[model samples]
Target chain A: MTAENVTAADPDTTVRAPVPSERRGPSSSAPRMLWGLVVLVAVSALALTTDGFVSVANARAILSSVSFTGILAVGTVVIMLSGNLFSLSIGTSAAVSSMLFLYLLPDVGFVLAVLLTLVAGYATFALQGAIVGRLDGNAIIVTIGAGALQVGAVTWLLPGSVQVPDGVDIGFLTRSVLGLPFPLYVFLAVALLVQCWLHYSATGRQVELVGENKAAARAAGLPTGKLVTVAFAVAGLCTAITGILLAGFNQNANLAVSGTFTFDAIAAAIVGGSSVIGGRGSAARAVLGAVIIATIANMLLLRGFGTGVRVLVEGIVVVLVVVAAQRRKRSIA
Target chain B: MTTRPGMARLARRSRRGGLPYVLLVVMLLVFVVLPVVAGQQVTSFNYYNLFQVFASLGLLSVALGLTMIAGEFDLSVLGTYAFAGLVAVKLGADDPVVGLLAALVLAALIGALQGALVAWFRLPSAAVSLGVYIALLGLTATISDSKTVPYNNLNVSDVLDRQYLEIFSLRSIIAILAVAAIAVTMTYTRFGRDVRAIGSDRRASLRIGVRVDSILVVLFVLSALLSALGGSMLALSLAAATPDPGFDPLIFALTAVLLGGVSLRGGTGTVLGIAAGILTLSLLRELLTVLATPTYVSSLATGGLLLVVAFAAAPGLNAWWLSMRRPTKRVAEPPSLSRVG
Candidate 1:
C-alpha cells in the first residue's frame, strides 16, 4: 500500500490529519480579521480613556519593551512551524549570546562581535536541532537540558556581569531609526523577512508539510531532518539579534537579563494563535501577539495593576487561544 | 485473560529496566563510598541532610514520573510547588496541618481543571499545563506580594528536621512511606495497568473501555497532590516560603525522571526506578557539598547528565549506530534481494 493510504488507514494517525488548505482560506482569514478589528477598537478605547496612553513616548516604551521578546517570539514561530515545539532555552541562549557580544565587543569591535555572537547562537541551536531532528530526541527536554548546560557553563566561565570596556562604541545599536528604537526596527525587519520566507520559499513549505505529518513527509522523501535543523538555525539567528540589541541597549549584559524571555516568547507565539503542535503560524502573527501583550501590559501599568495581574491575563489569553484553536480544529475535522 | 498477557509484558519490560538501579549503585559507590574511603568523615548528620533533600525533591520526581507514565506532561508542577509552599507558609503559620491541607486541596482543584481541559478537548498537556504554570506563578506572586513569607513557628522546622535512626526524619519518613504506597499501587492495581495501557495507545485504550478521561484526571490530581505535599513539607522545614523557588526543582525532577528509565514516550517505567534516580541525585548533591566545590559544578554535572541521558535515549541513535556499524550492508544486498528475503 502507498504511504498515504497507510496513514489514512491508521485511526491514530488519522486523528491528526493535515488540515486542508481550503480551511485556511476565507474561513480562517475572516475570524483573524475580526480579531484584528477588535484589537484596534480596544487599543483606541484605551488611548481615549487612559491618560498618557496616546503619547509617542508611551508608544516608544511599549515597542521597545516588547522588541526583544518579539524577536524571540519570531524565532519560536519558526521552531513551531517545523514541528519542534517551543525551545525552553531561548532565555539562556539569549543571555549567553548577550554575554558573548559584550565580551567580544571590546576585542573584536562592534560589527565583528555581533557577527560572531550570531554565529555562536546559530551553532548552539543547530546542535540542539541536530539532536532533535537527526537523533529524534524530545525537543522540549533537549532544550531544557541545553538551557541548564548554558547557564552552568556561563556561570562557571564568565563573571556575574559583563560590560563593554571604556572607549567602546555601541551607540549605533541603541540609536533610533525613524523615531523608533533600533531593536524595534530589527523586530519589524525580521518579522517581514521570515513571514515572506515561510510563505514563498520551497524549504518553508516543506517545513510546514513535515510538521503536518513527519512520517508522511519522510515517506514522500522530503528532507525532514534538514528542514527541522534549518528552522532551528533561523530561530537561533533571531535570538542572537535580540541578544545583541539587548546588550547594546542596556550597555551591559548579565545572566539575569533574559530571565523571562523564554516564557514571554512562548506566550507571544501561542497568543498569536500559533498551534503549539506546529505548522500553522507566522512571524507576522507572532509580532502582532507581542504587540498585543505589550500594549496590555503597558495599559495595566498605567492602571496601577501589578506585574502579577498582567502575567495572569497573558496566561489566560494563551489558555483561551489554545482551547479555542483545538475546538476549531475539532469542528473542521 | 487480558490482564494476564499485560502483566507478563510488564514483567518482561521491568526485567530490562534495571539500568536506573545499576546507575544508582554506581553513584552511591562514587559519591558515598569514595568520599569515606578518602578519609572524609561521614557522619549521621550527612545522611540526615541527604534524606532531607531527597524527601522533598524525590516527591516531585515521583509526581512527574506518574504523569509522564500516563502519557501527559505536567509543567505546572514547579508553579504548583512554589504556590503550595507560599500558601502553606502564609496560612499555616498557626497550624501546619491546616496549611498543608489547604495547599493539597488547591493543588487538586488546579490539577482537575488542567486535566479536564486536556482530556475533554484532547489538547496537548504540555501546552495546557504551561498555561496553568504561568497562571499559578502569577497567583503565587499576588498572594506573597512578590516577597518571601515567613512562618510564625520556627519550631515547626526543627520538629520536621529532627533526625532518627541516623538518617530518617519525620519528613523523610513521610516521603518514603508515600513512595512505597505509590509503588505498591502501581504494581498491584487495575488503575496502574489502565494507566500504562492508555499511555501505550490512547485510542486503543479508549476502544477497550479504559475510562481514559477519568484515569487521566485522577493521575493529574495525584501528581498535583504529591507536589503540594512535597512543597508544604519543604516550606515547613525551611520555616519560610518564596514566591519563586526557581527552575532548579523542575530541572532536577525532569533529570531524575529521565534517568529513572521512564521513557518520554510514556507507558514504561517503575516507581522504584524513580526512587533510585532521586536517591542517586541526592547523593551526588551531597558529594558536591562535602567536596565544597562551587555550586555551579552541580548544575553543570546535572545538565550534562541530562543531555547525555537524552542523547542515549533517542530512538534514532540505535538505528544510526546499527547503520554505522554495517555501512556496506545495503550495498552488499540489492534492494530486490533484500525485499525478497
Candidate 2:
C-alpha cells in the first residue's frame, strides 16, 4: 500500500509539490491492513455460514470464473497508476474484440483471429491514447464517446449474435494445468508479469513515474507520452484478450455481449487497494481485489439471492470503496 | 463582482447570430430543406414525429447542459430516468397525481444523496455516478421484477396529452418551460456566475466566496429531477414503462450538449446553443427514422458527430455565433502555412 514510501525522494522523484504527505509513510498501510482483515472475516463468515462455499469445486469455480475480470482489473489498475484515470470503453473494446474474434475464427482460423483481435484492440486504444495523452483531453468523457461510437458501429455492421462453429475446439483453453483451469493460469501469469514489470523493469518504472507526475517525468527526460500510450495500449490488449478467452470458453459472442464487466474490473481495482489518483498499486493487489469481489458474488449466489440483490450489493460496495479511497487520497494530499 | 465585462461581451455575442443559431439553421435545413429536396412531404401531419423526439430528448439535453455548465457529471440521472418512469407509471396506474408525486419525491431523494456525496467527498463525479447508476439499475429491477410494466389503467392522455397547435404536447410545453427557467437562472442569476467561476477556477471561486459545493449540489439535484421528469413524461406519453431504458439517453443528451457547443471542461456555453443542438439531433434522428435505418447506424452517426463537434467547436466557440461561413477576427489566416491533421 505504501509503495510510494519505498520510492525514495530522489531530487528527480520529488519534482512535484514535496509535501509532508510524502513523508507520511506507514499511515497508508492502514487501508491495506484493514482490507486484509475484511477479506479474512468475510471469507470465514462465508465458509462458516454458507453451504458448500469452502469446497474445492466452489473455490475453483470462483477463481476461474473471475479471472476474466481479474485480468481486466490488472490492466485498469495499471492505467490508473499511470495517471490516466479510468477508461469507460474497456467493456466496449472487449465486446467488439470478442465479436471480432468470433467472426474471424471460421474464416481465418484461431491463431490469426486472436492476433488480429489483439491488433484491433491495440489500434483502438492507441488512438484513444494518442488523443488523450497528446492533447490532454478528458480521458473519461472521451472514452464514453469512443465507447458509444464503437457500439454504434458494431451494431450497425452486425446486430445479431454469432456462435463459434462446433468443430472449432476450445479444449486447450478450457483444459486445466497443474490442478487449475487454463484461464486461471493465464490470469495469474499476466498479473505476475505486470507486477514484475512495474517493480523490476526500467520501462515499467518510467510508466509509473510518468503517471505519478507527468510534469516531473517530462523534466526528467522520460518519454511520458509514449509510455502513457503504451499503458493504454496494454489496457486495450488485456480487455481484448479477456474477450477472446471468454468467447473461447462460452462458444458464443452475441452482438449484445456486454462489457459491463468494465465497471466491475474498476471496482475490483479500487477494492484491491489501487489509487484512482494514479502511480500507486500493483497487479497482484488488483487480482486480490478481483478475488474479493468474486467471493462476495459467490456467497450471494450460494445464498440464492436474485440478480437484483447481487447488483445492488455490488453497486453499494463500489460507492463505499470510492468514498474511502477518495478520503484516503485527500488526507495524504 | 467583476462580472460586468463578461456579461457585456456575452450580451453582444448573443445578438451576433452565433454558433447556436448556425446550428439552428442546419437543423431547419435538415428538417425542411433536404427532406423537400428529397421529395419527401414533411407536413404538419408528421411534425409531431419530430416534436416527439425533441420533447423527449431535447429536455434531456437541456438538463445535461445545466450540470455541464456548472462543471459536474450526473450519470445516475438516466437511471433515475428509468426509475422515475417506473414509479409514475406503476403508482399512478389509477391516479397519475399519486404517481407524479411519488416519482418526483423519489427522484429528489436520489438526487440529494448523490449531490451530497459528490459535494462532500470531492470525488470524481464520473466514478461516483457509476456506482449510483449500477445500484439504481438493481433497485429498478427489484421493484419492477425485470418486467416491462404496461401502463393501461389510466387514460394517460387526459392527464398529460394535451396538445398545442396540433403538434406540441403538454410534455413539450413543460419541458420548454423548464428549459426556459434554467436558461434564465444560468444567464441572469448570481448562482450561474458562481457556477462559471467555479468551473473556471475552483480555488479562486472559493476565495471569491462562491458556495461551490452548494451550487454543485443544487445542479445535481436539478439534473436528477429533470431526468426523472423527462423519464416520467416519456412514459406517460408512451403509456408504458420499460424496466431498463439504460444509459442511451444519457449518451444522446451528452452528444447534444456538446453539439450545443457546451465545453466539456464546463462554463462558456449557452442554453440556446444546446437547444439548437438538441433540435439538430432530433431532426437527424427523424430523418434516419424516415429513411428506415437501423438503430445502430443512427447511434454510430450520433457518436461520430459528437466527436467531430466536440473537437471542432472548442477553438471557434466565441467566433461561431457570427456565422459558420464568416471568419472571426482572430481566426488565423490559412494557418499561415500548410498543416498536418
Candidate 3:
C-alpha cells in the first residue's frame, strides 16, 4: 500500500521532528539516487557473471517457485501489519489443508474440494484472529497452541499414510499458459488484487490504521478488532490456496514438507522489507522478497548441497538479511 | 465518559481479587480434578507423567518467554535445541563434556547472531528467526543425514534410561536446577529488569537510559542457551536426536508458558507460573493417555484446551465482560485520538 507522504513545508520543521537521522537526507536527489546505483550495480554484476540467472526460462521457473511463498508472504504481511506476530499455525494449517485436499479429492471433485478448503482456512484463521485481537490474546501463543492441535489432527486423521489418488489432475491450475506457469499467473493476479484491496479499499485503509496504532484506531471508532480478524481470514484463504497449488505442483500433498514452507514464507516477507511492527508493507515488496529467498533456495539445490546444506545456507542468508534490515531500521530511528 | 469514577474504581478493585482466582479454580477442576475423580491410578500417574513432560517442556517455554517478553520472537530456539542435541549426541559419544560444550557454544552463537541482528540492527526477530529456523532445520537434517542419531553409547543410554531421570524423580535434578537458576536470573538480575522494562514499554525504557538493545541481544543468547541445554538433555533421555522433536518443544513449551499466565505481550507472569503451567499441561496429557481415549480424540481435546486457555489467558478477558454490568466506569477516559497524532 502506498502511504501518503506528508512532507514538511519548511526545512526547519523537518530538522525539528524526532525523525531518525538515517532516514533523512537532502530531500532532493540523494537517497533514491544512491539506491538506484546499488540496483544498477547488482544487475550489472548478474549480467556479467552468472549463467542463465536472467534468462526468461529461469525467470519463469523462479516465478513458479515463488508463487506459493509469495501468496503466503502477502497474507502474512496483512496480519503482521495488523500488529500480530507469526501465525504459528500457518504451516500446519497449510499442511492440513493440502492433506485434506488429497484426502477429499476422491469424495468431492477437485474444484469443490479446493473451494471448501478455502472456506475452512478462512474460518480457522478468522477465529484465531478474533481471539487474538478482539480478546487481546497473544498471537504467538495462540498460534503455537493451534499449530500443535493441527499437527495432532493431521497425524491422527491420516495416520501412517495418505496420498492423492492417481490419474486425477488439475491441469487448469498447474499447466503453463504463457511463458509462466498457471500458478505464477495466479500468484500475480492475487498479488494485484491484494495490492488493490490494500491501497484502494476502505477496509484496507482501516487495516493499516489499526496496525499503525490499534488503541488509537479503536479510540477513533475504527473496528480494529474486526479488521484484524479479516486480515487473518484473508491470510488463511491465501495460505490455503497456496497449499492446494502446492499439492498440484508436487502432484501429491505431504505433511512433512509443511515446515519448510512456513519458515520460508516468513523469510520472504522479512527480506522484502515488511515491518514486523505492523502497518508498513506492500504486496509487491513481499512477493519480491519471496522470490529472492526462493531463488536462493533453488540455487542451493542446483548446486547439489542437499537438504542440510541448503538449510544452513538459507539460515545464514536470513541472518544476513535480518542484520541488514535491523541496521537500517536502527539508523533510521 | 459519563460513568462515575468512584464506582468504576470499586468495581475494578473487586474484580482484581475475584476473577483470576475463580478462573484458575475452574480450570484446575476441569482438567485436573475430573480426571482424578475418575480413578486413582488413572489420575496420579497421568498427572505425574504430565508434570514430567511439562517440566522438560517448561525449560524451553521459559527460554522462549524470556525473549518474547522483550518484544521479540525467537523461532531459532528450535534449531538451537536440535543442533544442541545433535552436537551433544555426536560429541558426547566421544566425550560428554566435549558434547555439552559444543552444543552450548553452537546454541550461544546462533543466539548471538540473531540477537545482535534484532537488538543492534533493529530487525524483527520473528522474520530473522524464521530464516534461522529453516537454516538450522536444514543443518540438522544434513548433519544427522536426515535420520535419527541414536545414543549408542551404553553409559549415556543407561544414564538416560534410568527411571530416576524422569520428571518427579531425582534424575530430574537437572530440571529443578534449571528452574531455580531461571527463577534467580529472571527475578534478581539487572538484565531481567531491563527485559521487563523494555517489553513493557520500549520507548519509555530507552528514554530512562536502559541499554535496551544489548539487553535484548544477551537475553536472546541466554534463551537459546537454555533451550539447547534442554534439547540436548531430551535427546540424551530419548537416546536419539530427531529433526522433528524440536517442533513439539517449540509449540508445547510456549503454550504452557502462555497458559501459566505469561502474557505474549510480555512484562507479565513469573517463572513459577510458567513451570506450573507446564506441569498442568503435561498432567493433562498423561491423564488423557491413561483414560484410554481413542487415538483421534486427544488432538481435538488439546485444541479445545488451547482455545479455552487462550481465552482465559487473554489480557483483561475476565473483567472485560463482567465490568459491563457494573454500575460504575472511568469518567476521564482518553478521548479517541487521531490515528497518527
Query: DockQ for each candidate?
Result: 0.47, 0.29, 0.41
Highest lDDT: which candidate? 1
Candidate topping DockQ: 1
How well does candidate 1 reproduce the true complex, by DockQ?
A: 0.47
Q: Please give the TM-score for the first chain of candidate 3.
A: 0.83
User: In model 1, which regions exceed 4 Å deviation?
Assistant: A1-15, A18-48, A329-333, B1-15, B328-341
Which of candidates 1 and 3 is the stronger one according to DockQ? 1
Candidate 1, A80-172: lDDT as tens digits? 988878998898899899998999888888789889999999999998988898778889888888888898999999888998779987888
The better-scoring model by DockQ among 1 and 2 is 1
Cα TM-score of candidate 3: 0.83
Q: How close is candidate 1 to the true structure, as a TM-score?
A: 0.92
List, in order, the clash count of every candidate structure: 0, 5, 7
For model 3, what is the alpha-carbon lDDT of residue A229?
A: 93
User: Please, what are the lDDT tens digits per residue for candidate 2 over residues B1-341?
Assistant: 57999898788767543776687677777777777777776766466666666667777677777777777766787788888989999998888778877888898898888878877887777778878887888788878888888888656755566667887777777887888887898889998788888766676787778888788888888888887888887887788888777556876888788778777777667787788788777777777766667788877887677666655544333333333466443221222222222
Worst 10 residues of 3 chain A by lDDT: A1-10
Candidate structures ordered by lDDT, highest first: 1, 2, 3
- Which residue pairs collide, candidate 3? A81-A279, A311-B135, A326-B121, A326-B123, A327-B121, B50-B282, B50-B283
Docking outcome class, model 3: acceptable
Which lDDT value does model 2 have at A92?
Answer: 68
Evaluated on CA atoms against the true complex, candidate 3 attains a DockQ of 0.41
DockQ-best of 2 and 3: 3
